[model samples]
Target: MDEDLMRALREDRGVKATALAKALGLSRVGIYEAVKRGEIQATRIGRRIVIPAHVARRLLGIEMEAA
Candidate 1:
């Protein structure tokens, strides 16, 4: 993972699908595909879909802090 993306994930509470797709160099449809395949987890907040920071970190192989 790049430093900028790591920093963004670390600082943000959650990431939107578009931002996540950009970070991963994927299209929005790719993100949707991942969600369908259960490769990434997402939650819908009204019309917006949000991916938790911890989940993104895990997908990037970043160690998460113990809760």
Candidate 2:
């Protein structure tokens, strides 16, 4: 994967299920099912479930940003 793409993926803040599913070649339904099963951590705010950027990176085994 390109470094630029990785950076963009890491910084992404929108609903992650779609992007993550596409990147991992998995279905969006699978992603949501995983979240519902606690395979990944996500929080519900109002009507949207938001997966934090760092949490997404961690789940994908991507490196964290330097402190």
For lDDT, the strongest prediction is 1
**Positional deviation of residue 61's Cα in model 1 after best superposition, in angstroms:** 4.1
Can you write out model 1's per-residue Cα lDDT over 1-67, one digit (the tens) per residue?
A: 5565566677857777777787778998999888878888998889787788888777656775543
What's each prediction's TM-score?
A: 0.68, 0.64
Clash pairs, candidate 1, are: none
What tens digits encode model 2's per-residue C-alpha lDDT throughout 1-67? Answer: 4454466555665445666666667897888888899987887788666666766677667785664
For model 2, the stretches where C-alpha displacement exceeds 4 angstroms are 1-15
lDDT for model 2, please: 0.68
What C-alpha lDDT does candidate 1 achieve relative to the native structure?
0.76
Clash pairs for candidate 2: none
Q: Report the Cα RMSD per candidate.
A: 3.3, 3.4
How close to the true structure is residue 31 of candidate 2, measured as C-alpha lDDT? 81
